[model samples]
Target chain A: MSEAIKDLLKKNHMSVTDSRLQILDMFYHAPGALAHADIEKKASDKIDRVTIYRTLQTFEEKGIIHTIPTADNSVKYALCKDQCAEGHHHDNHVHFVCDKCSKTICLDDVHVPEVKLPKGFQPHQSNMVVNGFCSDCRS
Target chain B: MSEAIKDLLKKNHMSVTDSRLQILDMFYHAPGALAHADIEKKASDKIDRVTIYRTLQTFEEKGIIHTIPTADNSVKYALCKDQCAEGHHHDNHVHFVCDKCSKTICLDDVHVPEVKLPKGFQPHQSNMVVNGFCSDCRS
Candidate 1:
């Protein structure tokens, strides 16, 4: 896993650092999207908040991760697929937020359906978020 | 307009105050959703940031306005329709974020289409946001 992380950072032209490696590892193991607080808690005071924030920003800029917006204004970050690259993202899938467990999962297989806008409206991209009970919580 | 604002506040069981009235007025006249910075700027230093924050919270809790989540994690607020009441929001319409002008408009008539989740997922509510050029910017 650490070897893969090193290669990813090298491919993105970012230096291999402990903070970046730890953060990326957490995303790899996360069941769903992770918020800033989650990363902070998982670091167990080893990494400062500023470092985590900066690492997340750098990762996002390099397209290593994507952000998921929530209704309550708390943004969550998740690992991006191999399609994503620097300054370009192809994450067009729908995001699902489990109401029971409050976990946000990327439904990569389910694409966002196109909506018919009023005349004179030109669409570029669309994002859809569905609140529901995930498979784990359903049972 | 002031009388209408007062009545709306009264209906929500909130006392009419300068800060609340001013913030509510901003939402009424806004062309699109207003963010925290927008509200603060429109207040012209008459209202403090804390007051503006509290007023927005009160209005949201009362269902006077609904929040639209943006990709940048900055939540925008817009006035709710008459159908919305305290603790209930019927703003299921699609939100349009204009990539050209950076305006987030509520397409009241464009409802969010139902999405088919995978098996074992039970949906409760869905929110859709489309990014594009609005009618004014299309030309």
Candidate 2:
């Protein structure tokens, strides 16, 4: 767990702290992206929910993670990509929500396409979510 | 107003209703996009919030509109593209959240780029958001 946090910190160029490490590891080992409630439940009983919330927010601000909004409007979080440029928010990526497991998985490799905007409007990035039943669900 | 509703309904192949027409035109005349709250605020107070919520859900189900999750986690919705297919939802367009106006505008013509997904995962559609000060805001 510590190693996971260290690696994440190194990748993000963030100074490693115990709290950041714990939160970073939580996201790294998470098989699927986690919602706020889920993170609070599984997080160490010692960590306050508000602390976890703040941690998540800080991580997002630091570009260590990004959010995925599900059909149910629950927000999920996942690790950012290595290529995510510094000084920029996390690069937009695809998020997959599996119908069977109801798991939101980050398709980090998947990049959202560039879009052409109307006059006087300038576009910077994009987010894409693909919703469907997964292979396990179909089976 | 009735004709406008009729045209929107026929254009999107959705059923026309007082609430639906009001909601559609509310979005139509909106400079950018509208939250349910924005719709309520801009339109007559006669439409109940519950009704607005239900109507938005119906519109989403009908592929007439899609949602953009704001930084604050509130949803902002707008009209979809012409090719919006039934039973399928694609909001893979550029969403501009003007820092000045604080409005979310749907860039219909601007489309996100195609992404290649990882093995065992299928990519269907995506949503892209660009957050920055709009031209007006910059000015």
Candidate 3:
């Protein structure tokens, strides 16, 4: 785990710091997307709120992770695929929020479909969030 | 404008209040959606942050307005159509975020297309936000 985290940081041109390692490790093990409150609750006492916030921001800026917007005003974060890089993100996939478990699972295989926009509206990117019961919850 | 606000509030079964009137008035005149910060900046000094927050919550619950999630974690609110009712929202249209003007416009005519999900994932509601340059921006 530590080696993988170190390699990811190196690839993103970020320094291998304790805070980054710890946060990255959390993302690696998270079954679904994580909210800021979730990280604050699960993070070690040594790491403060501001540090966690900044680390998440840096990770996002580096394209190490992508954000999933929720209706309840809490933005969730999940690890990005290898296609993502600094200042660029290719995570054009659907995000599933389980209504029963409240787990946000990235359906990487399901790509967001294109919408027919009105004339003069040029689309750069699109995001789709589906609320549903996950397979795990159903089982 | 005042009459429309009052009629909308009465239809939603919410009593007309000064703060509610002011906030709803903002939504009515907004070119696109309005965020909490935008409300705070435009609201009168008599209205406090807490009042604004509570008013938004009530309005959402009463189905007077619907939330549009943004990638920046700031949830924007817009007025709902007549189809919406208490605890039920029929605002299934796509939301467009203008990259240049930073406005979140509700494309009322463009409906969200259904995506084929994996088995066991029962979809309840879906939200699609497309980021691009609005017609005004392009023009």
| lDDT by residue (tens digit), candidate 2, A4-65 | 56876777667777667767777778888978788777767457778788878778877777
lDDT by residue for model 1 (A1-139), tens:
5898889999889988889889999999999999999999998448999998999998998999999977767889989976486887879989999988999999988999988899989998888899888999985
Report the C-alpha lDDT of model 3 over B1-139, residue by residue, as the tens digit: 5997899889878899998999999998999999899999998757898988999999989888988977666878999965477888888999999999999999999999999998889898999999989998885
lDDT of 2: 0.71
Predicted complex 3: CAPRI docking category: medium
User: All candidates: CA RMSD in angstroms?
Assistant: 2.0, 4.3, 2.1
Scoring each candidate complex against the real one, what DockQ results?
0.77, 0.38, 0.77
* iRMS of each prediction: 1.1, 2.8, 1.1
lDDT of the structure predicted as candidate 3:
0.88
The predicted structure with the larger lDDT, 1 or 2, is 1
In model 2, how large is the Cα lDDT of residue A98? 85
DockQ of 3: 0.77
Colliding pairs, model 3: none
- The chain A TM-scores for the candidates, taken one by one, are 0.95, 0.78, 0.93
- When sorted by lDDT, best at the front, the candidate numbers are 3, 1, 2
Runs with alpha carbons beyond 4 Å of true place in candidate 2: A1-22, A44-47, A69-73, A81-92, A132-139, B6-21, B69-72, B81-92, B133-139
What does candidate 3's lDDT look like per residue over A86-133, in tens digits? 878889999999988999999998999999999989999999999978
TM-score of 3: 0.91
The alpha-carbon lDDT assigned to residue A86 of candidate 1 equals 88
TM-score of each: 0.91, 0.74, 0.91
